[model samples]
Target: MHRSLFNILSGRNTRQGLWGLPLLVALLISLWLTVETTQFATAENLFNLVAQAMPLIIAAIGQLVVVLIGGLDLSVGSVISFTTAVLALDQPAIVLIPAVFLLAALIGLINGLAITRFNVHPIIATLSTQYIVLGITRILRPVSGGTVPEIVIAAVSGSFLGIPYPVFWGIVVIVAAWKLLYGSRYGLHLFAIGGGIASGAESAARNFGVSDRRNIILAYMVCSCFAAVAGVFLAGRIVSGDPNVGLLFELDTVTAVALGGTQLSGGIGSLHGTVIGALVMALLANGMNLANVSPFVQTAIKGGILLAVVGLQSRKKMGL
Candidate 1:
């Protein structure tokens, strides 16, 4: 009886802790808004916040996949910039989106190859790719200005069947990610690969599970493709491909992943959790903006929160 009671208590505690992050974020958002102007909850402002969240959430999801594999993609922001520049340059439909995504994927694949084949660290490999990608983007489109096509403006700014396009895109990607993470063999491989490449492969190799090397490459490729998609949406939002765009996107992406309970050391977490973490971040930023928090102070606060959350999570693991 004592053992059964302990088990039930333990399970309940675990469930409560699991909800800590989301609860905290919800509370913060409420407090922030409550103290702000009464107009903060207007429909227009809510829609605006959703619009603003699209790019960050999209980019952050890409980061989430790579991080799960015990790797990082510092080049994401640069990829976004480059893709945006490519779109801004304007090409035929057949040539534009596909070509840009392919280019980004190739670049990400190269990063993966460098890490797995050449044995470079993910940080170093991706950082090198960041510079290379940025250099290319700059050379191709030095000027920040670009014309916004009417179709894109309407698609992004307008709702489809009364759903905000950005929100719709976010839901679609989230659902696709959920299916991939939960329903596919590739998803199982994702968790296994993070456990330690050799151990994961040797154990799962009996079934001829996913190649760790290939998965590493795929993680980066998926990351880059999402980054490209995010770039296009951002360009639409800004109505131009600003050369300085995607600045610090890497930082936000990493923070969201970490706060979502994915260990920096790698090998754990779910897409659902990470998506919620990103929404928390978006709400925090939007709420702060509405509350008139200074941008510099906002950065400091976010950094502090990240540090606290990481430290707490690390301790939790240690306790386990």
Candidate 2:
């Protein structure tokens, strides 16, 4: 029993990475919050917390898809902002919803092609796309005005059987992501490609007939689509469009991924870990708000967490 517990906590010989540590951190934070704040344990607050974290949870999952194959998508925030802007346009829901995802796919395709075909670094490619998308998003909405479709609003708000719709949204997204990451042949290919890249053998997966380039490209497209989904959820919540709504979301998603024990070098992660990491972040934010911490300080604290988490990674795991 002792040995099993130790192995579980240490994540010994596991490709899932050090998720156990984050799980413990999340529990500790929750306990502390519950003890420190009367509001923290309340039903309303707990539900609200889930709702507040849903967007990050969704975007982080998308980031995880790319990270699994040793890639990144800095443009996700911009994609999200662009999505909200498009959804808020004076257009019908059928047209606007499909258009949002279509544009996101195009953005992802461009990022993927630049990196795979043109040999552009993932960061540089996505960052460039980030600026371009943000520019277009600003052009679309200049400011946080205009209305999202009523259906979009309805999907995110309200409850069923005393549970908020956001809860259902999260469940559906999580279930779908779980299926894609763990229940598909493509998922296996992703880990294979990422493993090769992390091990300094970029062609390793290709040698095995994995078609690394195509899979990597698909990963980016999946990332952008997920970001668009988050954007739609956010637009519904805010009931409008805001160019800056997704500002720093890239940072948050990356941090959450790293915090969850997903190696920056890629090919080693778990969905549950990512979700737990996101929950930890949400808990911290909730606690900080309850403590009246300044938003600037919260941002700084988050940055510090990201730095510390990444810094703690071994040079071998980072492929440095």
Candidate 3:
């Protein structure tokens, strides 16, 4: 009986200590909100929550990639702003779509090259790029009016059999990220780079095959491309391009990533955690809105919650 009881306790402890604990928190929040508000658990509201969370999720994914390489992309918001402005320009869809994506990818490449080849620090490099991109956005469309193709906007924001496209896309991205991070060798390399394992215990990884530089470049590229996707989706949703659309988006993405269990210092984290973090954030906002809370108060609440989460994680890491 003692052995069986100990085994049961151990199982409970293991569940409580899971890396996916944030997801459980999010679900608990959802349950609380549902109890508090009638509309919070409705199918339509749930779908809308997923839809609105998609852009943030995408941005967080990009941030996660860069963080996995022990890098930061302070320019994600600026890139989103630039892409939105570019999309706002009056141009044909076929040409504009490819052109804007190419430009975004090029910007990412430059960021990667600057960090890897030129040896610029990731934070400084991305910050400089952010300012440059913001300047270019101002020059391109000082105003907030630009036309997104009707079809494009509809396809992205509309629903399929009562499910929003953003939700579908978010699911797809999550699955892909999960598969890549946990199921493949490339993913292991990324973890090695971020974890500093390649430079330490797995030192021979470099000599045998792994290239940290290449991995870093690819990470930055993926980040920028994902940011571009968010930008495109935003443009479609609003049916216009606003230079200020994605302002402070980096903060949101970073906060989500950090809350999701990814360490800012790099190495250990989960993409699934990031998704749950995004959902938690979105649900918080939604719930607050339903409760008629002020935006300023909501922001404060979010910050407080984030601090609490980080604190708890830190204590856990310290074996408290």
Candidate 2, poorest ten consecutive residues by summed lDDT: 311-320
In candidate 2, residue 271 scores what lDDT? 89
- TM-score, each model? 0.87, 0.98, 0.86
Tens digits of per-residue lDDT for model 2 on 201-243? Answer: 8999999889998999899999999999999999999999999
Give candidate 2 regions above 4 Å deviation. Answer: 317-320
Candidate 1, run of 10 with poorest lDDT: 9-18
- Better structure of 2 and 3 per lDDT: 2
> Model 3's lDDT to the true fold?
0.79
Off by over 4 Å in 1: 1-20, 197-209, 315-320
Who is ahead in lDDT, 1 or 3? 3
lDDT of 1 by residue, 145-165 (tens): 776555666668788777788
Candidate 2's C-alpha lDDT? 0.92
Q: Give the Cα lDDT of each candidate.
A: 0.75, 0.92, 0.79
Ranking according to lDDT, highest score first: 2, 3, 1
* Cα deviation of 291, candidate 2, in Å: 0.8
